[model samples]
Target: MLREYYKFLGNRLIDWSQTIAIQAGDRYVLNFENDDQVRQFMSVLSEFNGIHNFYLMTERSGPNALAFDIDPDSHMQLVVVSTVEVTPDYLVNLRNRIGQQQGVWENTALLFVSNKVLDSINSGAKDIGRQGGPFNTGALKRNVQATVDKSEKLSKDDKDVLKFMVKTIYDGEQELTLMDFADVYGIIEKGELSDSDYIQMGYFQDQDLATYSSKEERLAENHADYVNISLAHGFGDVRSRITKIVDGEKLISDLSGNNWQSVNYKQILAGKERLKQNKKISLVYDAEIMQGINEDMLIWDHPKGTSKAGQRTRYIIVFNDKHQNKLTVKFPFDATVQDKWITQSKINHKHYTVGTHKNQLVVDFSDLKTNEPESVKVRYRHHDIGSLGFTFNILILPFTDNKILGLRPYYRVKVKGEKKANLEIPSDMDELILGSGIQSNKLNVDKTSQLDNLMLGPNDQLKADLSQLSLDDDNESFTVTLGSVPLNFNVFDNDDNKIQPRVL
Candidate 1:
């Protein structure tokens, strides 16, 4: 019976096309035909020398025949031959039970007749194999493909780590240090070098620089060659600025316009390092140009509007010095006295006092660091009546030099209540009537003379005489310019309804 069992577990099963192969670190169950087949399997298992953690059951509903571990220490491979046609559900339960055994078994094989059992076993194992499994060329290829498919939705940093891991695995490296893992994974602990530090150190070898004779020439050549590479791997903010410099959209100089030179690769590298160290400060603000104003000045709005008080706008200002600098925001002299201004720093929770200095409302920011952005929220209410607008200035005073850096012009205008009216010019009518209902006929305007004299010079101003028309609650007047001609008319709304006129 033992000889028959040995043959059934080996060449006999192979010849009969009943052999089963299983990967290590997985579980399987063998279903026998009857008690006789189970007894034969037991006899074969007993003949094995090093099969440890053996468990034998008398009578059970499922796979209760025998269980044992087979690994290097056991000096044997486990094989179970059975002829019984078991259900897929029963085989799954048996597999789970075997997996719960005390010790892990290596190289387990199951021979059974049911196609359902075969299907269940194939679907039960995870596509990715467990760690420390016996390596097979086909399995390795499948695992690598599986890893690639799984990495589709991973983040860029995670994909980077996976790339390093894949390269290491492909190179068959057996050992890895913690520092190596940290570097690949981009984990900057207390003592480790930052990503910027690694980039600044330069990855090119000395052998790569053998062509250059002088040190300055070598550095210049290296900088030129490394620009593209560093731009590709640099930090997010650094990449954008470097791109702007490369595209000639921005200058590569300090705020004071000093160190003005063509784009240098070393300067960009140093900038990346400085960014990492929080040596640069950025101030974000929102500004827009007035529609009617022809000047190129942008009107700066309050940091937060009345409706969107929670939203923030970011502005950037780069400095040349490494030490902390004081920035003073000066408001218009009239606006300082007529407006109630409240200022707060969003980043460091620092309190800013709006005080008058040199006939202007000035808010000073001292000891500003670059580690985190310092955003100041300015909320103000204008109390003055008939106020036009005002211009504010941002001046940065660096301790290293007496030069003051004037960033930009920050102008703000008072909110006004006004309505837009559109007028239509008729081809046949020499005079047009303006107003609502029967009262509309009271005001009439002739545009033939105005149209003839519409020629305007650069500093010319065309004004209409409206001294005879009394504009009160009963009458309203507005002027519409056609080409360059100004036509004035009065409108009366009997029902006090607002009118929107459009030019046809």
Candidate 2:
């Protein structure tokens, strides 16, 4: 029988979160590392829509294969890569060959859980605690508390100084953030307190500070300033995370090992994120470069109709093979050659202006000078604001010559002049939810020991035996294990099954 839930990792139905959509002419592809993994891939074959064809490949075909993920139509046939840590050199060469050939297939990409065929990917970061990096509950608790103790303790005077210092920075949007507060505390601890102390409402009571504002204005301003900085850093964003600490326990996630925390909160606005990218240009490629991208990458601007994220420069690198190698190619490319690149996003809710910061993207020519290139054309993807992957409506630029070209995206964060995010780091980061970064109230979990298992019937009231459970830091929580009990046939099912077997 098929189980209602499968628990390999993240979710049994990992693909359920997204729809399996294929356009009328789209072709889909599935690739694997080995025979076992290939079988695993086939096990979930029932998940996709309109899967008409499947095949296995051992050699190279054409150019666009490397540039894009060998997708034919909007659909694809699975391509398997049984290799590990295929270097940028390999990826680049593959791209150059496939990229040189234009319009052979629709679009395509290589898919693998990890370079190892496991979820580890091709790097140093370990996912499961069994492999590397501590992921167990004990490790997590120590890390959390340590990060907290390492944080700065603010003094009354330090708080006032930091608040004033930050107000000068995000003056347009309000700065006086916790970071500014931390900075002041650091300075004070370092014994550099030539500046006056920050006493919250107490600092401005003196005649010297009063010259800046009246008592009424000072109080109102301080409250407003405090409210502003607290909201942006993901403070009490979720109600479930907020609770009264009576003996330090939360209403949820209190089953076993646990920790609870709160973050700084401030006023907020509702909106989505957008990416700043290079301009669209009418150009052509070797038609092989499309292999790297299977999904159509759409460039998006903000809904507010302005982007402050990218202006700095970074190269729109095109690899010649599976490993990244700059391709030597010439074509009418429509990418921006600006020197600026996106570093980080803005903190304020207001729309960021373009050209306020410098960011850049440029392709290196040295790699292209090599004999092998990944593909003929280069491809890039970014942001939900502009383009959708697979739309393919934009003009395709061709790459026939060999020379590295640089493309740049605009960024909102200022470098060498202003700072970002220092103020927004949460005071209680340990409580953040994985993936969503949502803060949750700390839960305590312990092994249930009672053998008198009792399955609570619908509308059943739960009475606790404090003797069987261990006392937790959170007084509200107690752990108990219950056993199944014999049910009398006289009991009725919710379905009103009287004569039916009650064992079910």
Using lDDT as the measure, the top candidate is 1
Candidate 2 per-residue lDDT, tens place, 56-102, comes to: 22333322121212234444432223233344555444334233432
Q: Report the C-alpha lDDT of model 1 over 363-473, residue by residue, as the tens digit.
A: 567765433223343333223111111222221212211111111211111211221111222122222322112211122333233333233322333343322433344
Which sections of candidate 2 miss by over 4 Å? 1-215, 231-361, 369-504
Question: Residue 449, candidate 1: how far off, in angstroms?
Answer: 22
- Score every model by TM-score: 0.19, 0.17
In candidate 2, where is summed lDDT lowest over 10 consecutive residues?
264-273
Q: Report lDDT (CA) for all predictions.
A: 0.34, 0.26
Model 1: how far residue 90 lies from native, Å = 5.0
